[model samples]
Target: MPENTERDWVLPTEIPFSELKGKDLEECVYWLLDAMGAKDLEWRIGGAGGGAADGGRDLEAHFFEPDEEGELRPQRWWVECKGRSGTVESQEVKEACNNALAYEGIDRLIIATNTQFSNPTRDWVKEWQRTFSRPRVQLWDRAHLERYLSRHP
Candidate 1:
């Protein structure tokens, strides 16, 4: 198990997503991102166990990609770790999207959920992209996260 891992690991799948809740889920996401080389990560809790709100974002990360001139251009990403039993609603993502407007440098919005997103939310993101294109959206549903984690694990 990773250093931040809260429990023992099982073979094949390793950590079971269903058994995790609240902060545990957030920690898992953080660990996965850390393992994958995302830098400058901040774990922000919002309205859970009486913690102050985090403006709809759960984790924030920074990435640097070389530009055409070989300059490292910084990209900021806001990650929301949603541990849901059902499909994630659009409002949740919308809140995070809208919150991005209040910040200056956020260039990407990553919605990482234990469950899949609602169809309406997908449509909303598509529509949202057609208008404003600054913060590229990346939806890491359960299967997507599994694929990424399984490779690193």
Candidate 2:
């Protein structure tokens, strides 16, 4: 059978910037994952989701691909989602990179933000790309968010 039920994508311009905080951030990440065609994955809200703390790493999700033997491996990924919170700090990106190391074997580390990172943070990311560039870390800022929304709309 051929699959022909393709849906058009649309960018949402109505999502208030204020609503992308905390729990809303997790939901938005979840929606993005779904839109990206990820299925049967487990995700949880850490840090603040457990109550009150530093509200670190708002949300985390995993995406896996089968190995050569058809075994589902941890060759997955970890996502750190942050809402529009002014400019993200270099330490924040550093934290996500550190977390990815703790996860080991992850194919990628994705930091999705509804905002932009400061100059220092951007430089930090660039340096990361230059050093220990194993678990490819991708920084998705506001522009990426807008594109995702539009493509899935």
Clashes of each: 0, 3
Clashes of 2: 3
List per-candidate RMSD values in Å.
4.9, 5.5
The model with the greatest TM-score is 1
- Candidate 1's C-alpha runs over 4 A off are 1-14, 46-51
Show the colliding residue pairs in model 2: 10-150, 10-153, 11-150
State residue 32's C-alpha deviation in candidate 1, in Å: 1.1
Q: Each model's TM-score, in the order given?
A: 0.83, 0.73
User: lDDT tens string, model 2, 11-89?
Assistant: 4666665567666866777788777766554566555443434233444445667889999865455667777668776
Candidate 1 lDDT tens digits, 1-153? 657858765442555767655688788888888887788989987664634588768899888888899999988888887787878877888876777777787889898888788888888988887887868888888788788878766
lDDT of each: 0.80, 0.69
